[model samples]
Target: MTSPTRILILEDDDGLRTSLRLVLEDEGYAVFEASDAEKALLTVEDPGVDLMLVDLMLGGMDGFSFIARARPRTEAPIVVVSARDRTEDIVAALEAGADDYVTKPFSVEEVQARLRALLRRPTIGDAETEDADDDVLTLDSRTPLLFDAGAAVLRRGEEEVHLTQTEFRLLSVLAEHAGKVLTRTALLQHVWDQDYFGDERIVDVHVRRLRKKLEVDSANPQILVTVRGLGYRLDTA
Candidate 1:
């Protein structure tokens, strides 16, 4: 049988941390708790964690620093949960390798929803399709489409597209819904694993970054095309 998904919660407040643990555990997730960045790093080393929830303000080693250090250690999705709701904070978190951010006073239901959505997103180096035939796609057998249920490895023709985990997740989402118009809200929900409360420019930056790796011309992108006000889409065809 498959093991339950494990989630790491790094928060300093005892009450809030316990509350989140209870709420997430009740939602059928295997939740792990850490009160500071040091413990959080230890938890990340376990390799069992499937996702992470981090507080921007911690007792020591703030979220930004934790993110910078932890990003290289794990491929799991990281969501920043904090009282810092400023646009700069959000952007900085994203820039620092956070897949998403949630403000303080957030509902447990919202957290649960975001966690589920992020877990549903396809991992990197996974194939989008289930066909055993290799001819169905030309990309690596490991990652046939950007968001295939299997694993996905970003590629540009014969070259492998080396992307940060956040960038890989963003590209995977777009490639999964290829040819379909995905609104900024939808992208935020799926790729960033959060509500659409933050600036949409976050998506724009990541998309530009992704295009730079996948497209020959990032300015005039062909694969990752903008759909005007509708947001973006991948031209798989």
Candidate 2:
């Protein structure tokens, strides 16, 4: 039998962490809890961990530092659950390696849905059918960047590129519609599988992140280009 999806919850707030654990356990996940970033780091390295829920304000080390440190250890998606609602905070968390972000006072349903969406995402080497037309997309010939959909991997020549789940999803959507400018709204719906209105910055952040990986020069991106006042397009040509 397939093992239950493992989720690590790192929050200093005892009440909130316990409540989240109860709710998540009830939903059939293999939930693990940590009251601080230091403890969470101990669990983040486990390859069995499928996801992580982290709070920014934590005793010692902070959530951002934990995420940055843990990122190289595991490919599991990290979702920041914090009271910070500012755009800068969200962007900072994403920059620090968070796959997604949730603000304080968020509903249990929203948190659950976010986790479900993240866990449902296909990982590299997952045996799954392709949804896009081309199973492999060539981003640039010179740089030799390619996204192999069936393998759930992006490669630059012989080297396999490491990408966060959210980043992969964003690239997949853009690759499926290569040469077509997709608005931030459409990208949000397709990649995140949510309306996520007014949070287009999420797309922008991931796109910037992707550019760093997919382009030789992120500052002068050609493969993934943004259209002025419109949106973004992945040029396979």
Best-fitting candidate, scored by TM-score: 2
Lowest summed-lDDT stretch of 10 residues in model 1? 132-141
lDDT tens readout by residue for model 2, 1-237: 989889999999999999999999999999999997877888876544889999999878999899999888888898899999998999999898888898998999889988887777655555542544565556464767778775677889899888877787788778778889999889888887654433678889999999999988899998889999999999884
lDDT of 1 by residue, 66-122 (tens): 998998888788888999998888888877778777888899877887777777765
For each candidate, what is the lDDT?
0.75, 0.84
TM-score against native, each model: 0.75, 0.90
TM-score for candidate 1: 0.75
Model 1 scores what on Cα lDDT? 0.75
**Candidate 1 at 160: error in angstroms?**
2.3
